[model samples]
Target: MKLKIINSDKILYEEDVFYLKAPGLNGYFQILENHTSFISILKKGNLKFKNKKKIKKNLNIEKGILKVNKNFIIILL
Candidate 1:
């Protein structure tokens, strides 16, 4: 899956990720390729993902909005 992280200034990161772990409003959830489209609010926490070969990495973030569609994902923090 492709992920993009943006803040008030500019885009922070953009890359292909195997999967992503995010803190949802109610709980935490994982996003993978072909996952259903949805939107949610996030809390202060780490946003984790994997590279093409499945190497995991993480981005620490504060409150933000998350959106996912069939083609791509956009994360605004």
Candidate 2:
């Protein structure tokens, strides 16, 4: 899935990710391609992603909102 992270000023990251691990209100959850569309609140933690190339990275995020649809992901922090 295509993932984009943005703030008030500019886009932070944009790429195709095979998998995503995010911090939900209750706990951490994972998202993959073709997952159901939904929205969730995010907490401060390490967010990890596996890209199309299979490269993985952990990023520190503050409070944010996560939106997931058929084609893309928008993370606003």
Against the reference, the lDDT scores of all candidates come to 0.89, 0.93
For model 2, the superposed segments whose C-alpha errors exceed 4 Å read none
Indicate the residue-level lDDT of 60 in model 1: 89
Query: Model 1: per-residue lDDT, tens digit, 22-53?
Result: 98888889998999999999998889888888
Off by over 4 Å in 1: none
RMSD of each: 1.0, 0.7
Q: What TM-score, over all chains together, does every model reach?
A: 0.93, 0.95
Best candidate, TM-score: 2
| Candidate 1 displacement at residue 61 in angstroms | 1.1
- For model 1, the local distance difference test gives 0.89
Q: What's each prediction's clash count?
A: 0, 0
Clashes of 1: 0
